[model samples]
Target: MGFCEVVEGRHSIRAFQERDVEDASLEAILRAARRAPSAGNLQAYRVAVARASSVRRLLAQAALDQGFVAQAPVVLVFLADAAASAVKYGRRGETLYATQDATIACAYAQLAAANAGLGSCWIGAFHEDKVRAALGVEEPLRPVALLPLGYPAEVPRMTPRRSLAEMVLDIREDA
Candidate 1:
């Protein structure tokens, strides 16, 4: 499908098939994430893949009892490596750029998963400390998003979206 169709067809998938995601498909998703544009090309992000049941259970608890977090065959934790970017761009990199880099990478991964005929859910609601502890993430690396990926068991309806006229604005000085 084209990019527009991909975007329009994609939705958060909470129910997934029991099968594991293929290694090649997972690699493609990760590769797409790496290709995402980063601030200064610093790639100030890291991804933690959790496939073990124990780890997924811990992540589910960290994610405020979101059972679906553990239901998928794989869970990807996207981490913002602030220290890596801060070395070059200082405070702004640490505070903003790294977070943006991680978020954009996650977005790319989601799109890639969708394009590959797989399903994924972007989970942002979680306890940061618990997530870090669950994934053994350390200081200077902050968990930004948790993505659960697999073949979907249920199809989600398209959620409503705001129109461009309502969401955008243009300004000019002259009439």
Candidate 2:
């Protein structure tokens, strides 16, 4: 599918079918994420893929009882590897660039899933500490986003968006 189509076709899917997502599909998503740009080529990010029922259950609870997180066949938890960023860029890398890199990767993964005819929801409403504990992650790796991926059971109606004029500002200094 075309890039515009991929972007336009995607919706925040909260309901998923009982079918399992193919491994190849997940691999494609990972590939897209891996290509995301990062500060200083550090690629300071890690993804925790949860496929087991017990683990997904814990993730769902950590995601503030967003049950769809557990219902989906897989949940990918994006983590910011702060120490990796800090090694080169120092405090700013740890405090900002690492998180920015992880979020970009998550966005790429979400788009890749949509392009593959898969459904995904960007889940950010969760307790950070709970997420770390659920995923058994230690320090320097912070969970930044949760992505629940699966086949959509319900395709929601398109929501409205702001016009370019309303959303953007032309700062051309010719004024």
Clashing pairs counted in every model:
0, 0
Backbone clash pairs for candidate 2 read: none
Off by over 4 Å in 2: none
Residues 35-101, model 2: lDDT tens digits? 9999988999999999998989999999899999999999999999999999999999999999999
Candidate 2 similarity to native, TM-score:
0.97
Residue 34, candidate 2: alpha-carbon lDDT: 98
What TM-score does model 1 achieve against the real structure? 0.96
Residue 24 in candidate 2, Cα distance off native in Å: 0.7
Per-model CA lDDT versus the true structure: 0.95, 0.95
Cα lDDT tens digits for candidate 1, 1-175: 9999899889999998999999999999999999999999999999999999999999999999999989999999999999999999999999999999999999999999999889999999999999999988788899999999999999786799999889878676677
Q: Give per-model TM-scores.
A: 0.96, 0.97
